[model samples]
Target: MKILVIRRDNIGDLVLTTPLFRALRQRFPEARIDAFVNSYNAPVLAGHPDVDQVHEYTKGKHRKGFSPGWLERLGQMWRLRKEHYDHVVIATPGVHPRQIRFARFLNPAHITAFVPPGWKMFGVDQPVEYLGKDRHHLLMTYRILLPFGIEGDPPAPRIAFTPPAHSPGEAPVIAIHVSARKPSSRWPEERYAELMRALHERHGARFRLFWAPGAENDARHPGDDGRAARILASAAGLPVEAVATNELEGLIAGIAACDAIVCSDGGAMHLAAAMGKPVVCFFGESEAHLWHPWDVPHRLLQPESHDVADVTVDEALAAFDALRQEANAA
Candidate 1:
């Protein structure tokens, strides 16, 4: 069978859908599994053992209200028609009437999608209200697609990427992601520095810092921490390398390279968790139970009160210390 899965969203959302890819391949060993994803996340599917093809869409640019150009949409429709897919599944939310209309235009044997609380899943779900909570969106989406006759289990979010592997002989490593795009999401840099200091005292030179590439522009621009590089330099006390270049594949590889990750609650944290890498994620303005790493040796540090900043360096350090102990025990 030929199958097409659409998950044109962010890096984190794409990572969450990989488990579904694996499950689909396992069930239909002879099937072709293709994904339509945002351009930024297209690379994440690189070297995935299960996927046969990947199509990229420029939705981020299209969202700014520029002409996506009718020809581009026409080209996609033509490609889908030519591929002759037997099944099509849209894992992304906000499935428009037009999207469903187009899928029906192709005459796929099955089409599955998820609709929010008040919305209807016209062809499937028989138009049930989606009352599930947040973060469970990934699971809910997978469940919705299953009834369309796609054979697969609810997959634990796992990403596949080939990185320069480490020898088992190396000392235990600690991975850290010290920056985030949004200020409200970023933990104070000094807090990171202090945590690094504490970690160095405990692990010495064994720790490594992995940074999201392209973040340098955010750090170097005049308004964005003109001295951010130097600040991170002083704080981390170790050379930070750009492992993930704002692409899904690189992000997955970078996370896979690490034994554990200390990150703010963002795409990287989600990627790390999906890889089954132990994670210590700091949170703000989000619930830990909803977003924290699942089924992993993990800890979530969210603010006690209304202010997310209330989670101090001390609390974060304490969490790190606990992770370290777990590592040693393992």
Candidate 2:
């Protein structure tokens, strides 16, 4: 049997869907399992052992206002139709109509998806209701396989990146992901610098600042470049180094090299969790229960004001200290 799982979303979302791939492979040991993801997130699934193939959809290049890239999308659809998949699972929490239409084109024998609330859908062999409160996304994505008796607390997100050659360096090297697409979720740069200094003094820990290139060019809200620079300048005498990468794979490699991560609630945090590294995550306006580091020893610091900037340096240091204690205990 052949199975295709579609989860065309961001890095964090793709990471959350990994357990579903594992479940499918476990249930059908001899089946060929493939994943369909967006180009930006394809690297997360590229070297996955459970997935036989990784199909990338370049949404940015192909999507426009109303029409989108109909010609290219249709051509890709035609190719998928010829794959003769035995089962197709729409592994996203909320299934979009366009994705539903695409699944139809695959002509799979069994179709499964999570149907949004208050909308009826036809042609799906199995449909699970989306309940997005308190529940983590890893468990949420695994619900799509309920009809096949694959039900449990899904395994944590795991990735298979070729671990970079071990470099003998400072112990407990902490990576600080200093960017968030949402401003509310971004802790102040000066505060981050303070946390770094504190960690360095307390544990002799070195720091790595991780940020995506062109993040400062985002028209919606441009500030990451300035933040990265500010962090470096503030840590002038400290052992803090900035590590920026344009490609997802490069970013993964950089994160893999770190012993742990201090990041906002975003892709970098999820990546660190997949790599089985302990994390100190700052949550602002984002939901903590749903998106916190999964199955990893970590501490999540949230502000009462609901703004990441309101989370004090001392508070962050305390969290990091707690994370270190947990790591040491283990």
Candidate 3:
């Protein structure tokens, strides 16, 4: 049997779909599993052991509504028509009519999608209701893949990549991803710097400070802050280094090799959690119950409001200290 899992969204969305990949692989060890992912987030699944192929779907590249874009869509659809898939799973949360049409275009044996109760549709059966009251988004999506006999615990999504070549005896490190793709989710830089200072003072030679790829450009706080760099210098005990490449896969491998990570509620924290590393993550304004890292000794500091800066520096430090204790115990 062959399967194609389609999730076309941002990094976090792609990350959430990884457990489905693993589940399918476990159930059909010999079957080929392909992931249809957005081009920007393709690297997250590049080296995943459970995935046999990575199919790129460029957003807006083939989207034309009866205009000049129609031809491009025709070409892309023609390419998709060539692949014979035994099953096609649409894992993206938001329902798009075009996705159903695309699945039909694949001419698969069957397609499974989520449709809320009272939702009526044509040519689609077995509507899977949104799993209510289950907060974690990744876990919720994993359930949709269950009917195909891909059962059991959906392990947290993980990425596998080669760590960048490091100089000999590089110090133990704590990666800090201080930015979020959404501006409203960022924690204050002053607080982050203070936590770095505390970690440096406490751990001394054991801890190095590092910034994640794309953080410098992901979200910008007003005043053109150099807080991430400053914190690494004064609070981090060792000179900072960039990953060999800015690719998300390389970033995950680098984080996996770290002693721990301190980050806001973003893709990096999810990666760390999936790697089973100790993580201290801040959450504010976003839904913590839904997006928080899973099954790891993680500390979540949430703000009362949407502004992540509202989560005080001391609160985050307390979580960090707790995570350290947990890591030591483990």
Candidate 4:
């Protein structure tokens, strides 16, 4: 069977859907399992044993500096249509009408997706009634494959990347990501500076600071250069090196090379989980249970006030200490 799984969303969302590809490959070993993803998240699947190929497209807004010709896009669409996939799984949660229409044009023998109660999602051969809460759970995306007789606590996410070499007695490297896509999730850089001092003193840890690149004032993709600068300045004497990741793949490689990660709940946290690294994550505004790192050793601190800023530096230190203890015990 030829199958295509479509997941066009944020980096974390695409990572969450990775388990499905593994399940598909296991169920039909001979089948061609390809992915239909956006350019932003396509690198996540690089070298995935289960994924035979990736069909990537950039959204109109994402085509700022690099836009593939319309003829190229048309040719890609035509080739997909010619493939005549036996099954196509809409790997997103809601009934996206535009994507639904797009999937219909592919002329797959069967299409499966989650449709809300009242909405009749045309062309979806198998519509799983979407439970509102399912979207929030990290592994709940697996429900999309139930109709195909695949069921399990979807396996941990996997990303293929070579990690940097590590020595025996050197201090463990920790990836510190300063990403605040949502305003409420922003944590002060001073607190991060304090935490870095404590971590280095207490655990003898080195740091690789990762963050959204580009100017914070960039209209299209506003990032955290200003915040990262402040955090670096505060840690002048510490072993905190800024990791310049110009591409999504570079970020993945950096995380995979680290021993652990400390960051606010976001794509970075999810990527760390995928690489099987321990994590100390902060949850604010975002639901803790929904987006928490899955199947990995993690401590998610979401204060009752529901703000990351409200979380203390002492709390972060304690969490890291605990993870280290767990490792030593193991």
Query: How many residue pairs clash in each candidate at the backbone level?
Result: 3, 0, 1, 0
TM-score of each prediction: 0.82, 0.92, 0.83, 0.95
Runs off by more than 4 Å, candidate 1: 60-69, 93-98, 116-129, 148-153, 163-169, 205-228, 236-249, 306-308
TM-score for candidate 1, please give it: 0.82
lDDT measured at residue 233 in model 3 versus the true structure, 0 to 100 = 53
Full ranking by lDDT: 4, 2, 3, 1
Q: What local distance difference test score does each model get?
A: 0.67, 0.83, 0.70, 0.87
True-vs-predicted CA distance for residue 135, candidate 3, Å: 2.7
Alpha carbon lDDT at 8, candidate 3 = 84
Please give the TM-score that candidate 3 achieves against the real structure: 0.83
lDDT of 2 by residue, 1-330 (tens): 989999998899999889888888888989999988888899998778899999877775435466556576678888988999988889888666777778988899988887866656876877777776638777777788898899977877889875545456546788999888777888887887788888999998888888756656777435467678878998889998788777788889889988889999999899999999999888888888788889999888888877888888888888888888887888
lDDT of 1: 0.67
For residue 216, what is the lDDT in candidate 4?
A: 89
**lDDT score at residue 278, model 1, on the 0-100 scale:** 77
**Candidate 1: tens digits of C-alpha lDDT, residues 1-330:** 998887877777787778788878878889999987877777768768889989876764434456666668679878787888887777765445666676666667777765566765556433323446644556656665556455444767766654446776565566777656555566766666677776667665245555544434553421223234544666654535534334445556666776788888778888777767778887776656555676678888776652446778778778877986886798
Model 4: ten consecutive residues of lowest lDDT: 131-140
- The Cα error of candidate 3 at residue 277, in Å, is 1.6
